[model samples]
Target: MSPDLRVIVYPPDAQGGRRVRVDGEILGRALGPNDLFEFLRQAAQDADDVCLDDGLLIEWRGGGPALGSPDAA
Candidate 1:
């Protein structure tokens, strides 16, 4: 990913789905890594080049890659 590229994974909603944004444009909701990968793949066509664990490339809010409601029992 380019140094100028910015990907933000917003906090999960009540259903445990997160909104994905690339460079400020909202792509869609992702329920897991595959969902997020597809979004990035379509947006940049270089999903293989991205690393979910790379903090500099992706900004994960509320939680990391784990999928679940923060308040879920």
Candidate 2:
């Protein structure tokens, strides 16, 4: 993961599902632990943060410098 590029994994919902959203847009959905990890991994590649249900907040710490800017540098 890049320094400035953080990855967040929110807690699962009541039904045990997670969502990958950015700026109020739905990107994907993960329905299990494995799927959630995979989602987080993929999101990490782009250094993006994800929220499970637009509430919980979980993020990866101690990353290197961002490969690019958030606006696509």
Candidate 3:
């Protein structure tokens, strides 16, 4: 967690898909098609648990192509 961390949220795309991006990096891309609702709920919980003063919580919503290899990011 960095003091200068930033959060950005991108709304789901036409296909109701979401991603998670932190700062300028893509954390994960393309959540499960059948689990979008559960995903969002869990994401909200996870984001809420994060200490805002510590780092940042970012959520990117959309069905666009995932940025990079999710595991290495």
Candidate 4:
């Protein structure tokens, strides 16, 4: 994952799937980190080299990883 790439994981939807966007382009919906990784991989990103915890790489909106609901407090 390039440091310049802006990755955003949106809030979880009713089915607990989150929308993933890379560089302003919506890749797809991810249900977990593995799904997100696959999406990144398909986007030509170094998924294995990318750290999901790195805020510089991923900007988790509404909730962070481990959050499974949009209503999560």
Candidate 2 vs candidate 3: which has greater lDDT?
A: 2
- Model 2, span 1-73: residue lDDT tens: 3344333434455654455453344556555434544655655542144342322343412221121112211
Clashes of 3: 2
C-alpha lDDT values of all predictions: 0.82, 0.40, 0.39, 0.84
lDDT of 3 at 33: 28
Residue by residue across 1-73, what tens digits does model 1's lDDT show? 7788789999989889999999889999888888888998878658778888789999999977774533322
List the candidates' TM-scores in order.
Answer: 0.85, 0.36, 0.35, 0.86
TM-score of 2: 0.36
Worst 10 residues of 1 by lDDT: 64-73
Higher-TM-score candidate of 1 and 3: 1
Error of 4 at 10 (Å): 0.3
Which scores greater on lDDT, model 1 or model 4? 4
In the range 7-30, model 4's lDDT, one tens digit per residue, is 999988989999999888999998
Candidate 4, number of clashes: 0
**Could you give the candidate ranking by lDDT, starting with the highest?**
4, 1, 2, 3
For residue 23, give model 2's deviation from the true position in Å: 8.9
Order the numbered candidates by TM-score, best leading: 4, 1, 2, 3
